[model samples]
Target: MKKSPIETVLGILVILVAVSFVHYAATKIDVRPQDGYTVSAVFLKSGGLESGADVRISGIKVGSVTGLKLTDDYAADITMTIRDNVKLPKDTTASVASDGLMGGKFLLLEPGRAKEKLNDGDKITKTKDFKSLEDMIGDVIFLATDSGDK
Candidate 1:
């Protein structure tokens, strides 16, 4: 087929526009972790928590899970990289929580009201294990059956 000059120019323009759009989207949606400081927390279990999971405070993302390790005490040691701007207290608590019933897992950071601030590489001594939906449901059922029997 014979193509005119206008057709060729329009095709080239479309290709250029597509490339520009991809570049723009890539830059805007980059999920690479930014410069941050690291802190460690130990949980009884990872509970499906993986590296790159969100580490949030008050439902807002302030950091991310950078690594996971098993400690000699049989606990899940999680390494979190938090933004340098966010300072946490020494007594802060870290808990593994789900987004909802049967939703994804994330680290929930509950900052403590204390005079001491946590330093980089410091360990978070307090942590709550993740409670699964089945556990809660079983407890509810057990309570209901026991009450009915009584």
Candidate 2:
């Protein structure tokens, strides 16, 4: 059988749309790894944190989580690449935080007041592990019940 002109035009239109999408993805949404300095932080819990997750400081993405591993001591050791321009202090705090109530997790960095700066591959000793929603709810419930009992 032979295809109609309408079918041929429809097929061409679909191909054009696919090409446009590919071009947009390649140019606008960069999937390539960014070049930056690498630092690590160890957490007691990952809470579903993954590689390629955003590393944010003051709600802005300053870097990305490049690697995640379970250390021998059973901690979540996360290696991240931060922008060279964003220098972190030696006492910077790193935490596993969720974007929102039901959003993905990211590595949140809180730069400290130290005059010295963190060097390449330096481990952030001050870290907070991920706290899930359930944990927070349980804490609140415990406090509420304990207050009533008193």
Worst 10 residues of 2 by lDDT: 141-150
Report the C-alpha lDDT of model 2 over 20-111, residue by residue, as the tens digit.
99998889875877878999999998899999999999999999999999899988889999999999999999999997988999999999
In terms of TM-score, how similar is model 1 to the real structure?
A: 0.79
Question: Which residue pairs in candidate 1 have backbone atoms (N, alpha carbon, C) closer than 3 angstroms, thus clashing?
Answer: none
Off by more than 4 A, model 1: 2-28, 148-150
Structural similarity to truth (TM-score) of each candidate: 0.79, 0.87
Best by lDDT: 2
Q: Looking at model 2, how many pairs of residues clash?
A: 0
Q: What does the lDDT read for residue 74 in candidate 2?
A: 87
Model 1, range 1-150, lDDT digits (tens) per residue?
A: 899999999999999999999999999774875678899999887789999899999998999999999999988999999999999999999999998876889999999998898888999998999888888899999888885644
RMSD of each: 3.2, 1.9
